[model samples]
Structure formats: structure tokens, C-alpha cells
Target: MKTLTIRRPDDWHLHLRDGAVLEGVIADTSRHFARAIIMPNLVPPVVTAQDAVAYRDRILTALPQGDRFQPLMTLYLTEGTDPDDVAAAKESGLITAVKLYPAGATTNSHGGVRDIDKAMPVLERMAEIGLPLCVHGEVTTPEVDIFDREAVFIETVLDPLRNRLPELKVTMEHVTTKDGVDYIMGSSGNLAGTITTHHLIINRNAILVGGIRPHYYCLPVAKRENHRLALRAAAASGDKRFFLGTDSAPHVDPLKECGCGCAGIYTSPNTMSCLAHVFEEENALDKLEAFTSLNGPAWYGMAPNEETMTLVRQEQPVSYPSKRDTGAGAITVFDPMFPLHWQVVE
Candidate 1:
């Protein structure tokens, strides 16, 4: 199919870091996605309804003039989070979901939940109110090898939590392993996963095979090639349980290039193009809309976007900027390691 049209996609997960970084990168996503479940892991994190609102306002202010994009706010889940405030945020429609970072799971997550028991009050409240909890589904214990974290998290953390509160809706953000895909596919309800653009395209080899490629490194780091295939199959299967969450995390060049580099891949700029290439390769291009546009909103209890975007495949390879200059520094855009032929018609 040379030309395809679908509803403007919504990113089930995104990170528009606060301040200058946010200002610089907001447009990259806003250009394609209609809405996004904006991640709350800022410098201090958005842990309260007021914080979500303030952060949402900042996102809106940062949006390039005339860009019609919605930032679905979320609270950073902390042990001390007030149930009443979360419920109020829901009632007022100020926040979309609550985020769970297992303290030190990823960047700015040192403030995350250390003990699940300590967070029961908030989690239980969220269950009662039918609010979603987007989890960074990985165990942080030191003994577990980095590549094994996602599978271990499924066995030790996620399964027990789901059994304990079947009513709670949880999005296993950035499912990098087949274990994650199978876990979500086997679930009956209230469990879904978001597949990232880079995970669908690259594996652990992208990071370590040819020296250290910092930009390819991300939390719950890419797994084996077979896992990437599982993710690809799940995404292109038209399964309601899996959808797009670019997880387009941006880290400045210096932070990524240093000895103790950060974990993230910035894919916002060329996500749609990369996705189109993937779906086309899978011979499942017809299912692209379901994965990118329809499933996420339905899972989040909203209607799919009415607006549509058309992608036209051209003979010539499309070119995207390798670096995005933010006020913070130059952030590297994800290199898919292949030429993209699909272009979103402006």
C-alpha cells in the first residue's frame, strides 16, 4: 500500500520533560500524535493533582502555536500520595492515570515506590475509582541481570499485584520482552501493554554489538531478537491489549555519552515513519490504525481521534534530523538503522 490513512495516533506513553527540554521537544510529538499519556517523571516529578495541572499547563504553554495537541496528565505514584487527591483529580478530569516507578527503575525514579505495601492505600483507591496505573514493569533488585528484569518483574511483581487487585487497570509501559507480551496476551482484562517504537525495531545488539550506542539504551532495555519479534507480532496482530507508546524519552548528548550514561531513546521525531515501515514489513499494514490510534483510547475509556493522518510511501528514502537542538543540549534522535520510506503527509 503506497498510501494509507488512519486516525491521528495517540501516544499511550510519552515524556515531555519540564522547562527548556520540554519546550524544545514538545513539537516533535505534537506534530503527529493527537494526545499522549504524558509521563510525570520530571526533576521533582508530578506527584499531585495540582502538580499535574500545573505541568499540563506548562505543556500546553510549550506547544508550538496552533498545534492542536492534548497532554493527558498523570501523577507520579509515591507511597505518601493522598487517595482523596487522586480521587479528586479523577472527578475533576485533571489527570488520566497514575504512574508507578519502582524506585530507581529509570531516570528520575529514585523517588518511586520502594515498597508496594506502603502504596496500597493509593493503589486501592485508584482501583475503586477505576483509574489506570501505568507501571515501569521491571524489578530493580541488584541480583537480577539487566536483561532478565522484565521477565522477573512479571513473575514477582506484576502477577501478584494483578491477582491482589483485579479491578485495577494497569498498562505495562514499554514491554521489551516476550514475557511481557505473553503476560499481557494471557490476561483476561485490566491488563495491557505499550510497545515502544525502538523496541519494535532494535534489540540488545543495537546497544552493545558495535561499541556503546547510548541512544539505543533504555530502561527495561531491549531484549533478544525473538522478543522483538513477539513485540512486532503483538503490535501487528490488531490486538486490543497492545498499542503504541513511543516512550520517546530524550536525554541530552552529554548525559548519554558519559561513563555512567542514562537510559532512553528519543523517537518522537520519526516514530510514525518507523512504525509504518515495520507494519509494512509485517504485511500487516492494514492493522496499523488499531495499534496506533484505536486501541489506546478504548483502553483508556475514550473515543478514537476523529482527525486522520495519511502516510504516503515514496520511492526515495526519507531523511530526518539526526540531532534535535534543545536549549538543554543536542538530543540524539533514535537511529532505526534503516532507511524509512513512509512519510506522514503534512
Candidate 2:
């Protein structure tokens, strides 16, 4: 067996839905990741310091025994979010970042910020406090073609925001387009991007090529082959600005199979195996540690975990974890569509 070991990876972006779904999926993430930035787009949304504390408690309760996982909490940025509360959360280390989801952008995102002007109070405070903003990075305007949303948002929303507040650390989460890659690569400071495990492996084809595979559909939806190539190169290039954020969102199978399917792809179960395969294809397996482990910690201003994870390349392909059972429902696992050869050794 060919074995590769590196510092344990962290998920810069992840969604652990509350209650039963949270209980069922927490182990898949905690088993491998030392830490993850838990998204705040809950049903009612985590909007206050008190809410963060309660949510953190629930996450801790859901964590599987013997798993050493830290849930880095975040507050959801809304038109009415309190700036003083945001500053205090950062001061107390109760929250790691603030998430900005444009209203109607994705699942449970209806409460997101619709007017940037209304959110300036919290945002300006984040800039002063040095708390990062993790953005969904897509505009929800009806006229913008779904495929063009990411680029359009960059030209209109993201760039302007960055220019206005250069000190506000920003994490462009689940970046799916070449425009996002180039923009981040060209940034001089206070900017970084998290490339998701699924985005690196699939393109728009996976969603529409063969009669609508809803499981493959996600917000900031996958783009063209050229864009996928850009993401792959950036992730494997060992650039500190690009790192792993699984955005490993899980939705029930029933919800995904319907006409109005939800947007998400659960990847925490086998992200490392999928990543190893991609890095090996690029002939940059040595750089996997940088993308998966090192760069993310550096961007968030935290030290890399002392613990390590190992992947062994087996002669046979790794078994597919087609679906994970959460008490709420059966959540389908993301299928890379190619055989995974690297198995994470316990």
C-alpha cells in the first residue's frame, strides 16, 4: 500500500443541520477533521451571541464519543444583525466568522442580507475586530443566469465590498468558477477562497448531462470544464489562499428527489479519498497537505492541528458510501462518479 500522511485537515465550510440531522452527520466530520467552521444558516438562523452559545452546545452534544472535533461557530449576517454583539462574539472567541448569504441564494438562506447597506454596521465592526466573513458568494437576482451568478457577484457585490473594507478578512466559500479562482489568485491581501471537495471533481455536466441529477446540484453551482480545471490547479498549486471547505451539506433524499430539489452535496464521509484521487491525477500528490491542512489554518490565523491523518492507496477502489442515515432522513453521499482508490486509515 502506498501511504501518505499529513496534519489532520479542517473543513473551512460545512453544514451540520440541527437536531437529528446534526446528530447523525457529526461523526462523519468529527472522525476526520480536527475543526470546521459551522455554517449559521439554521432554520431560524444563528444571529446573536446567545444563539451561538446554544448552537455550540447542541453541536457538542451531538459529537460522537472519542472524536476530538471543534465546531467553530459563526453568526449569520442579516439586515438587522447587531454590530456590538458581533464584536463581543469575536472578543470572547464564541464565533469564528460571520456568514453572508444573499437572501434566496440557497437552502435556508431566505433570512440572508438583501441590502448590504443595512448590514454595514455588523460588517464594519467585523473589519475592525478582524473577524472574517464567509460568503456564499452568489447573487440571487432573478435575471442573472444561474451559471453567471458567481462571476457577476464578483464584479458587482464582492469586489465592491472588498474595496470598501480591505481589512475585513473574506473567505469566498465553495468557489465554483474560474473567475473566482483568478480573482483570489490575483488578490494582494485580506482575501482567500475555499474550494469544495465536490467542486474540484464535478462540473455542470454532472447536473444536466444525464437527466437532472439533483444530488449533484448545489449553490454557486458547478461551472464548466475549464472552471473545474482552474479550481483543480489552484487547489493543487499549494497556494495558501486556496484550501479545502467541503461545504458538505446534507439534505434528505425525499427533498432532493422532488421537483423543487434542495441545493447541497454531502461530502464529509469521503472527501479525503476523493481529494487524493484528484491530486494524484494532477501529479501534485505532494501538495495535498497544503490544500487540505496547512493553508486553511494560516488564512484563519490558527495553528495547524498536531494530529495527523493517513491515506493508503489500495489496489482496489474504496467502497462508496451511497447514503448516510440521519434520524431525520436518509442523506445521500456525493458520488465523485469515478472510483476512489485512497482509503483513509483509522
- What is the lDDT for 45 in model 1? 90
Per-residue lDDT over 125-215 for candidate 2, one digit per residue giving the tens place of the 0 to 100 score: 8998899999989998999999999999999999999999898899999898989999998999999999999999999999999699999
Score each candidate by Cα lDDT. Answer: 0.94, 0.93
Q: Give candidate 2 regions above 4 Å deviation.
A: none
lDDT, model 2, position 21: 93
Error in Å for residue 96 of model 1: 0.5
What are the RMSDs of all candidates, in order? Answer: 0.7, 0.9
Q: Lowest lDDT 10-mer window, candidate 1?
A: 207-216
- Cα-based lDDT at residue 218, candidate 2: 92
Looking at candidate 2, the ten consecutive residues that score lowest on lDDT are 1-10
Could you tell me every candidate's TM-score relative to the true structure? Answer: 0.99, 0.99
lDDT of 1 by residue, 1-346 (tens): 8999999999999998988899999999999999999999998899999889899999999999999999999999999999999999999999999999999999999999999999999999999999999999989999999999999999999999999999999999999998899999899999999999999999989989969888889998988999999999999999999999999999999999999999999999999999999999999999999999999999999999999999999999999999999999999999899999999996
* Candidate 1 RMSD computed on C-alpha atoms after optimal superposition onto the true structure: 0.7
